[model samples]
Target: MAVYVGMLRLGRLCAASRGVLGARAALFRTWQEAKLQSVRPLSSREADRTSPLPIGGLSYIQGCTRIRLVSKTVGQCLDATAQRVPDREALVVLHENMRLTFAQLKEEVDKAASGLLSIGLCKGDRLGMWGPNSYAWVLMQLATAQAMELEYVLKKVGCKALVFPKQFKTQQYYDILKQICPELENAQPGALKSQRLPDLTTVISVDAPLPGTLLLDEVVAAGSTQQHLDRLRYTQQFLSCHDPINILFTSGTTGSPKGATLSHYNIVNNSNMIGERLRLHLKTAEELRVILPSPLYHCLGSVGGTMTCILHGATLILSSPIFNGKKALEAISRERGSMLYGTPTMYVDILNQPDFSSYDISSMCGGVIAGSPAPPELIRAIINKMNMKELVVAYGTTENSPVTFMNFPDDTVEQKSESVGRILPHTEAQILNMEAGTLVALNTPGELCIRGYCVMLGYWGEPQKTKEVVGQEKWYRTGDIAMMDEQGFCKIVGRFKDMIIRGGENIYPAELEDFFHTHPQVQEVQVVGVKDSRMGEEICACIRLKNGEKTTAEEIKAFCKGKIAHFKIPRYIVFVTDYPLTISGKVQKFKLREQMEQHLNL
Candidate 1:
């Protein structure tokens, strides 16, 4: 059968321009299906092994087989949930005083999808949905069934249209757009001209109208006609699970962010499994309220929180435009929110609120703590102070639909603190020995790898770079060094690249950092390796001391003398107020290393 390629331009094709351009569809490899088809039948004796690949003393595991996958597009998944509980509460924007039921949300989404169609966007067209967490943001995400780039990401992915806020607090999105497209000031809404962004044709603004941009409300209204509504349905009807529905940019700590293109299959199944692990099945059919403080641009918010909530017919509560601990606490108290999602730092801030005790967080039964390592102390505080008895920790990257392993609610506090839980359903994880090119034994540290539907379609337009990590068998090599226990729980030890080799001894920085966090005077710690001509790389620890506390590098070294191996102990200690962080709140270790190298003249 011949592959049908859709026209590249109509990701937002004007109504008048529909038939002027012929229908087109790109030919996809069909490799995934072909790989499945080529699987050879196993002999009775070989069937006992389960997996087709042979292994050594390596640690490898797959999720339970009993649970089947939900085969549907992201839009269709929402449609199913909305159909099941049309009158059920779907979204609550506490700060905005906005609420919507499943039926109402679906109606808005349909109208928005139609609006997109009326403006010329069609199936397979790239649309940039950029903004904070809001009801409209959620609508736009599903309406297009595909979603950022500041400029490079947009142009790299060939974004045809953009839907963003006029200004997010102080960030002037309109001004930035104008800088990129000087002609946008005079061009019509659907006829943008830009030397920098040649593929961009339309700009849709939220909340209010901007010069040379169309109001979001007008776009929705334009699609109110029956013809446009049918067009929206037609677009949804033809979408495939394999088609790319979203493009998430990786945190560019090491270099430029790679656009990890994800499909409906990649995220829909992942989120569904995540919901299952959270015990958010809603068998009683009652609404579960989840307060999300993470930005919608990140996968933790978009897929793990938003998409997961929709899959289970739960209410998603956006507490603030950005993370505000006080507002998050208030939303939980006032809305009786049962679930919460945030990074470990966010939870720390929430617990640090002076009046934190004043809020009634007794309504919270469970929550997800992710984005960064969940220190045991932080997890315990969230459990004890926040009254979240069923808190679970998760681990994954943006390239893996953001969630592959999640703790079961009933998991012991110790289990939750020590590991990132078992693999999610239908996913596979393995620990490969870095030097020998083989899987390692249980509890042995090695590079962690993941393979499943969640693996991305490869970095957008960078196949060579994509191949460097993702292998032919489809295993995406996570740079993280980890170990899986016999029970299948995985512990992230460190990053392979971040490992310190001092005098031929491998020293994992996370292990030292975890040890330093135990020190009473140390509030935060990051251990990095500084280049040294003598030992190759000497260990250094950057520490943030507790309030009103003072300590010397000698005292820190003395504390570690008898506790950990002498070689494992940091050779140098530097006290500081805070570590440099990325916009997403991850520590810029490379920056820390550079600063230390320059200071010490390494």
Candidate 2:
């Protein structure tokens, strides 16, 4: 995180010193106030085993290494399970010919480690795993863990040490490597122009070999497993609970995207808490077979998928490169996946498929859907039609390992239909008045503030950026507008900045879009505020009609009548084939806004 901040600082100072200082001062003030809000130091109750938690009392709840390094590292977590469930099938990589047991998977991880260590790769160096989620993808992450401990899991490892199975040979990779890490300065040496990182004293490849990167397989085979195993053990001794795994890229409402640094302890604990609440094999270790087609680059499929299954001695099914609806559905059915999880968009696509009912979706337990407000209609499809008993409406950000709220246990049908649910075990939430810069009371719509163990280490290389989002006491200002009921259920209304004011009335697009989703022909709809001369701004609906169907603006407007207020209905509707999205499958409203404004000549 310091690296990013330093670069931004250097860029600012070198480009324009006076403007840079002023911007920094303003940012620092915004960050300082946020920090103060986080560290308010509130009192709380302690939860543990025999403390009413479903999981056997949490062993690491009150300690720094509370969750323990082994429990957190993907390789270490799988290894622990390998020892206990040696014969149990731990992973089934699609098109890989066979299933790998816990023991076998650990061996693969060890091989990758030996390969890196043989080439003189030191501990705590960053290793980039940029390939698609596959058997080797999991292996790469675990293998890299053996060498680097927990310094870089979700983010790019910064030492320019190792690149993953695929997608790193491009110019983008080279630029990022050299720009982020100072070690690679003056990287383009003689014979290195076509040369892929000849400057790295040592580099290792995963599955295939690159010109400059050392072959991981060859290196691993040449060395002694016992020696590499000992080195792993030695590094594990110095592995602190809070060490970062990797850098994750997440979008900000205002900028391109920023890197979120996630630590081992944060990822592990959050997953543990999730498992406990869901009553996932709390009594005894069960053969919980989990299907993860959500992609390994993401927390939902990687950390959450791995930890949730491990907490119960379950197996992780990796069916990589799950393209569209058909691929995902096939993988889920093939694995007899017990539970499925992904963003709301992915599930919506799955449910909306023409073959939705054909698959044996009966084994699904439940799923967590975020990245956008989940419509009540979609939740009903997952629970009733899809046979998923636990359709949870969750909310969080990448900065917090992307989990903060779970549905309240005693929530009524109406509450669940209207809200995202309650705050999670180790987190606190409050509604902030963004305009007044004050915390608001219950039932009020305001910016949501989250603070807990689930929060990220910080933005990788951007300290000033980190301080801006993560306030004191570690509360992260989500920039999302929400409301907290008296029962503590936090319901997302929209992004704090997403409110489209039409003249004097505030129109939340999510609320209006919900009504449009109720229409049968409307497969997907995005609401954008278009600049209007008469109303200041008018609601615009970007609609994607169901296959072989169509709906006009007039008909859609009629359907929305009596469903929402008069002023909240969209004034303009434009049909489109697709919506622009972020990496996590979140719909980019800003993009939609730009598209509509240009179309209407505003």
* CA RMSD, predictions in order: 7.6, 10.3
Candidate 2, 404-509: lDDT as tens digits: 7666323444666688866566566667787886767667788887777778888767899899988777778888888766556667888856789899998887
Q: Which stretches of candidate 2 lie over 4 Å from their true place?
A: 1-76, 142-159, 166-204, 222-224, 251-254, 283-287, 408-415
| Per-residue lDDT of candidate 1, residues 143-262 (tens digit) | 111122367656766767776677777777788878878988898888897889898788777778787788878887876689876765555444556666566667655556677766
TM-score for each prediction? 0.88, 0.79
* Global lDDT of model 2: 0.54
Total clashing pairs for each candidate: 16, 25
Worst 10 residues of 1 by lDDT: 23-32
Highest-TM-score candidate: 1
Error of 2 at 590 (Å): 1.5
At residue 562, candidate 2 shows an lDDT of 86
Give stretches of model 1 more than 4 Å off. Answer: 1-57, 142-149, 282-287
Measured with C-alpha atoms, the lDDT of residue 494 in candidate 2 is 88
**lDDT, candidates in the order shown:** 0.68, 0.54
